[model samples]
Target: MVNTKYARVLDHPESSIRWDQESPLTMTVETREGEIETRYGRFVGGPADGVEVVEIDTGVMRVVVLPTRGMSIWKIESKGIRFGFDSPIAGPIHPSLVPIDDPSGLGFLEGFDELVVRCGLESNGAPEHDEHGNLVYPVHGRIANLPADALSIEYDEASGRLELIGEVMEARWFAKRLRLKSRLRVRAGSYRVYLLDDVTNELSKPATMQLLYHINIGSPVLDDGAVLEAPIEELAPRDELSAGEIDEWNQFGAPQDNYVERVYFTKLCVDDSNETTTMVRSGDGSCGLAVTHNVNHLPYFILWKNTAAKSDGYVVGMEPATNFPNKRSFETEQDRLVTIEPGETKSFRLSLLPLINEQAVNKTSERIKSLSETFEATVHRQPKAGWSDMS
Candidate 1:
């Protein structure tokens, strides 16, 4: 058996220590000569050694950015709280980490730790290209699996803010030339994680762009008695398997033997600020989590729930995207594809915060309620006969 015991301090001046069971051997130690007992810094040796990682900890939260993996946010942690999934493979594992040459879509699923960075500049669905075989986009595109060209981090002592910046290029000589410039900000003594992104078409010719923040949540934060709360205007199952239990879309079930996955497409209601939010809370009402994002850049939302057996690992995904992860060709047909003019750039912002106590959870509930009242809530009527399949 592997002994995964690890220890770390919470706040400066000797506060409490929290141990997370997500990663078996992960640990955070305070440095003697650091700014304040190791608040934030860049480090190697991610989930496993040899994998480069940059760790930034606000007294309230800790975020791990894998520079070698398209700057993916590999982990999110707080006192006795974890919001990401555990993969069988280790490290800030490289894209070629797997031995197979063509794992198809499964490649992305293998190293999908927490926040899998996505790029819509090329293709995002299964492996497929044009009839002429000129344009080739790998599964889930090539951003998350590609390494960042440049990575930097800065800490502001006066404002107690830490920012991690990463630049990733998904370009070829005669193909697309798109750049993703991402910045993540965390404030001391706060539970919020802010993300500001700017995707630019670096080429002289126009290029199609699609970006999705695939945020996955699992375990303690997502268990029985958990409920999904959002200003949802409409909900549709992805396929026949999910449509069977369409009524239970907002509730989670215990791990079962043969539990199939279900995905719900939601039309969310945005506030006057043009922002939409979603919350997932523990059944006991102890702790919870919330995600807020602007709707202008991200107009679509997807909720993926998988209640597979315990051995398989249970997880839920909250995806915000400019276009669904369908084939780029299909997205173009729907006219949902976003085109960036030569040298044109667009921005997207979002934040994730942990609801530590009842007060925090209640605040989220109240906020959702206010939004529901302020805007018109979509009334979902039962399927007239059999459920409609949209997958």
Candidate 2:
């Protein structure tokens, strides 16, 4: 059994330190003796102060957790493969410490370069004051920057699975009360990572809720010939820049100077499993990454592509959202906002799996192709089934 009693401050080797702090990490101090292990630590220095990182390895997959950022998975590695974008800006920056007037979303952007980043419990759009006339919500909402109030890490020896749990509360004495409880798990000798989230309303009144799984993919897995495949019923460009190159939405461009970002909103059709999937693979077809999510909870998909100068960063985001990231007011006008009544809870599930070889890539490609065809339901409607990466 794991024990928090063993937690302590851990210093980094001089050559291995990434931050300016002398000894910025504090974690549940434990020695690795098995193939599956979990560790939690924090940076005690300047920008990264109070930022906690948890590492979990299930022999086949290794994941880094950012507890300070709503338990976002910062990195995923396995079999010498890296599936996430490496942003020029590294480490976590608390949103509360950043100014809300910054239009570039710099505060949230600093940590946006991760494998997975949750968008919202209240809002995930452009900055604006709430309908109740409160101050504006920073870019992507407050959950990402709000540190988890409680955290636990455990390994199931019987199942050879590693689990990480984090609880974050977004409550002001008089405003909306909401709690986001996230549970993430990975199994031994498996190439998949699972996320199951539950968001509950603790207020006496109904509250607006919006969420998006921002899965960013870049170099290695994403290349010139890489394609974004999904059973898209229709596609619309977010702006004229995207409309200009709508024909090539599925293709990627070489990194360039002063490149403008383009976004496309796709209405997808799910398979019999009631799950929608999006994939990106290298031109060589040797490797790829596929993300599958419950379309019932997250029905919208946004493709955010930015192939700017190397220094600026290059990435493509395969985002699954409850609604498009326009202004909250705009989404309200469209009646797309998800409402959570008092004491009610909503569940969401998604899986990230690496396509290690061409066979795996081809299998995913075929599955996506089949999604466009008709298929009869064979299995019962199972909500938790989305946790399985095989989908």
Candidate 3:
């Protein structure tokens, strides 16, 4: 029988053993399926200097995880198909370089180029300011900018499961104290990557929170005529600009100059097990990517289409969130905020499957179609009240 192995990659409080390219820490283990390799290293130059990265090669897929960026997934590649956007922002940028608290409160975009990034711990959505115009919460919260306090790797040879774990704390004096523990798992010879996250309240008093997973894709997997398919139960445009093309919400077009973004908020239909899947496929249906999650935890989804010029960031975002990405005050008004008592924890799970061929893409498309056939989806031509700020 095979055994489970564990290794400590980083412990900021206990040691300063950070790895660089010249001397990266790597571990390879033999499993029944094949060989699994994990490497830990830090970027040395450019905007990504001092950024810690963990890369896992599962034979079928390769995933790059950023421990210094709230355990976000930088990129994923399987069978020569890359799954990430090419943003103008040359990142994995170090948190120090991002002015999250700038005057305009839009500094969060300075480093937002990840394939998957978490959007909460305290407040998410739009930036918030007080009556005096003082910034209270920066855009998309602070979790993405907070570095992990500890990181480790675990491998179960028998099951051929490999996992990278990280812990990030978002705490302060006289305010909310939350901890995010994230685990990224992959199995040898599999084209799927799984994420398990636990957000815990560490304060003596109860606290409220918001969370959203910003999963983005661009280029090859998201080209002209590409389509987004999901079992949407209820759907509404985010604003009037988006409402103009509500009929074509699921469709994508070629990148254009001066293209404005369109957003759609949706409540999805789930299966008997409370699970649902969303997918984006190439124009010819030759390749695609799918996201699977449990609806019991993530009750809302947002589709962001920004098909701008290549140099201006041509990308689409498939977000599964606890609540809509509105201002904290607006979300609170709509009663979309989540509250946790002291010592309590909330868990979230998500999986990404790369459809490497036409057959795989068709199979997943049929599954979504079957699920959607269960109910007639409601499509709102305009932004709906209580769901959109403009409404």
Candidate 4:
């Protein structure tokens, strides 16, 4: 490896070092424990685009987390303080291989000039076991928050208490598009998204309640081969479908020639391994994530990917959600529809459990049943024993 001593400081425990290389943003750090070393530190554009390298310790754990286009975390001052996550140059809005929106002729979803997901909130639906021992996936509601004037900025530096408190928002360093109102988590912590014209809304209910968020989970090591492992309890198939209608991934049919939309493997049990999902581009981001969680009320899960069509060999976009896309009206239903009466409020909490590929996928379901501490079914809906992954 070409090692060059770039001018920077290394903080211990929570120490960090940043280098403004000729290209992309790169940062490095060492844990206070001093046993961990991070390398391959980089930033990319959006959930489905370019990337920079991110590393920990001395190549111990590497990750390429960021978008493909607008490396906001790396390009803070370049786009000025007032930046948008819309990349008009990003082309179309289609997860071609999956059930992503085909927002063609209908015009695009106000893309980013550098194109990051521009919508205020983006959500995924999945299924699995809930905290109370119930089947879950595609939890209700989405994840996204915007302070009155949220900007796409970069993390000029990363260290202890990594954050920048703005007027209405707070930005953190050593993060993808490292700019967010620290206060955002205060209101958005519970996933109970709310909007009021008089409070934070620029206008009243307005014409539509439109919000789009590109929960970027980018990688910059795709050429080295990409591997994503997401586990769940069950993968259910959908019932009742209309011609050319949107259906679940497990229920998709054969495609004549063009690329097929996405296939969703629903209701998989979020066992120990299932909870250990992570994004790896090439060899970067190796064991960068330890665990994850669910934000919605449901426990189901959905996986997203950017297949062969993607240009960069160093980028990957994989996500596990709770429900299907555009299924807002389906909330609180037997499947996943919200049943709220007049002026009702609800909250959802989700966490993450990142693990290595070998630990996440190699282990079989038998191991889960054997290791399961407390396994119970609160809602014994007749197991739909049908739906499966089409891809």
Q: Determine the backbone clash count of candidate 1.
A: 1
Question: Which rank order by TM-score, best down to worst?
Answer: 3, 2, 1, 4
- TM-score for each model: 0.82, 0.84, 0.94, 0.39
Candidate 3, pairs of clashing residues: none
Q: Name model 3 segments beyond 4 Å from true.
A: 1-25
Query: What is the TM-score of candidate 1?
Result: 0.82
lDDT score of residue 152 within candidate 4: 23
Quote the lDDT for 2 in model 2. Answer: 26
| Full-model lDDT for every candidate | 0.67, 0.73, 0.87, 0.27
The number of the candidate with the highest lDDT is 3
In angstroms, the error of model 1 at 149 is 3.1
Model 1, range 273-369, lDDT digits (tens) per residue? 9998898888887787788999898887877787666667677778788866666666777777788899999898898887878899999988888
TM-score result, candidate 2: 0.84
**Lowest-sum lDDT 10-residue window in model 1:** 9-18
Worst lDDT run of 10 residues, candidate 4, spans: 75-84
Error of 2 at 53 (Å): 0.9
Q: Looking at candidate 3, what is the lDDT of residue 215?
A: 94
